[model samples]
Target: MAARPEIAAVIWDFGGVFTSSPFEAFNRFEASRGLPKDLIRRINAANHHDNAWALFERNEIDTARFDALFLEESTALGHPVRGGEVLPLLSGELRPRMVVALKTCKQHFKVGCITNNVVSMHSPGQDEVQRAAGAMGQVMPLFDAIIESSKAGVRKPDPRIYLMMCELLAVEPGRCVYLDDLGINCKPAAALGMRAIKVVDVDQTLAELADATGLTFGAESVA
Candidate 1:
């Protein structure tokens, strides 16, 4: 592209848009550690508490605690393994699709990355987002802002996190366009006046993105 299109800012999701789901992949690996496939699901359904990931994002918990607790949980559940098993998934499989969007955004307007990620790297079977800054997979190198749950201490479907991202980008929500694979998270952003796109497939999502954001996609570029 000759120059980035004109938009105030653009936000992209990490997992599905990138290589694949490191989150999903990690959970799958949990089986090797002797963790039941449903272990994570049950844990999330029950309390949403006790998990260091939540506290880590709000900046309440540190990396050490997050990692140790994860391992502890696994051992308690009869599955014991080191934390690094999760690292390969995030870095290796999570390819970058929004890189084009990021590149396009930065050329024209401000760009920010808003992801709900763990605050630090400590344990196994977790998305090793600490290296996200260098993860060419998600084109992390191109982001003007990278807000993951671990760092933000919050995940989507929470309006506060969306607003926080807007504030950090210094753009009004109306001027921003956000993309994620999950519609649940997009609802709040749309409600807040930020243009939102649910990225199901790269080309198709790009088409919707171009239409909604008014960014001119090349004739051949899929939405």
Candidate 2:
């Protein structure tokens, strides 16, 4: 078989790829409230392109507006959920194994991150922001480029965001490997000629990264 095309860069999605999924947190919240599973995800998926969650991620709305709007959206879906309640759930615990794989990938290829983050929810001055940075600081500095949707005014599933990362890395799309937790986000990357991996779990993702980059990560406990 012909050898796979050489990969020049590795792009990652921050939240779900590096950390436990916020969807897990959302489900837990839903269970606690006796709401349907995946309700928050459903709400966000509905009218995805122009939803309140999408606007919040692009920084087109402030926290207060997102709160009201998200509540409105959720209420329309059945349960009344405050956006304020959902904001805190977005930060999932970091996965040290994934960080190890990322570090391994960085040694071989240019590394970049494209995250659909919210500006209002992740204000630099917020305590949660400080804590999150402190917790993930070791991994943050390793990236050659980091694009936040809130700052970039574009989110994943939009072709421009993936293209922007390639431009920033000075790499061709066909020569890059991109990993994201959401299939919707992965579609555009794959369409752009990137080798896109939809992350399902740490070990699975690591195994694929290993296959793509031809690198092996240590199994030591860094957690």
Candidate 3:
């Protein structure tokens, strides 16, 4: 029988995994606008590599330009949605269970955060950025390294960024376990030999992490 690979580190995605998924907020925004559900997702996924979302995250485009380009793209898609209207919904409440899981993980393994995020170029955007920073501040100290797309100029699903993270942690990809809400983002990590979990439910993800690392990360751990 082969011995299990020793898990040396755990890498996490910020938005969807740590907080309630922004996708949930996106759906709410679509419904409030009387537009089709998943409209924002479809629009953002249209040109996955260089779309408005990707460009904005990479800081290649400011909020105002993203608003213009996003509206244009949605209009082309038959639903004219304003990017400004959806920006506020980008930040979701932090998940307490995920916080507990993070705490437990840090006790056993090196932890890091890698997020695809945008810069605050305007008012409410600035407010939103501050809010997110505040939420992350509570747990930032737990992370050994933090990488943001806006600052790094590279977003997930890009192999280089994943490699950069492994390099930052000074760990082999095979020795890391990664979690992200987006399956697309998890692909590159898996391809790089990291055990990747696509998070849908917080408990399920925590369970998977515990199994992978042979560490306890249940409700009891939080207590």
Candidate 4:
């Protein structure tokens, strides 16, 4: 292992970072449907690397295929759900404070986003593709670089994705702070020498970012 360097860049995970978590929506969906909690998550976790969700995120499969495949996967677990039904839930409300933190970080350090996102899944009633695009459009430009799994052909928890961001930003993993909502995702970044922050909420994440970057967001500042 190499010696750590002064933080030079900040890498963010999009969904649960800039916006609310889709898991919250998943739980709500499960409750409304009288299904088990974390049911959607359980299906995704079963084959973490090459499951239907993984294939969809990598754009290896289309929405129609994912719909049927996800249903198959879920049914095997006792509860069935079409992948199309889950797409709309992926759209999350953006966090204004987190966006402010990203803008603040940009002034001092290289900022980038690595998101494990699916290609457009135009589910019924809600055009998830359009919703995510419209919201991300305003936020994407704020980053010096952005990598979407749908475009990258690989997603986080894969060390390659973290390395790709470091390459794009011209920084080492040791000199970066990486934030994500999932511990499983954070592990790889941490293993690669980045300071990984598992985001639980807006306040916790912003405070940790300030601590790492010597920056301030909203009323939170680091001394």
Q: Identify the candidate with maximal lDDT.
A: 4
Query: Model 2: what TM-score?
Result: 0.92
Poorest 10 consecutive residues by lDDT, candidate 3: 121-130
lDDT of 2 by residue, 1-223 (tens): 2223498999999888877898998999999999999999999999999999999999999989999999999999889999998887887777888887777777678999999988754556556556565655767789999999999999988999999999999999999999999999999999999989999998788778778877766555245
What's the ranking of the predictions by lDDT, best on top? 4, 2, 3, 1
Instruction: Provide the lDDT at 114 for model 2.
Output: 95
Output the lDDT of residue 105, model 1.
59
**10 residues in a row with least lDDT, candidate 1:** 119-128
Report the C-alpha lDDT of model 1 over 1-223, residue by residue, as the tens digit.
3332445888877766654555476677766656677665443333344454455546676656656765665566666544434434454353434565556557677777777555343233334454543464337667877777765567766788888888888988888888887787789899989888887777787778767666656633323
- For residues 1-223, write the lDDT of model 3, one tens digit per residue: 1213498899999888888888898898778879899999999889889988899999999888999989999999999987777777777787878888887777777899999887772234457656777777776778999888999999998999988988999999999999999999999999999999999987788778777888766556455
lDDT of 3 at 30: 79
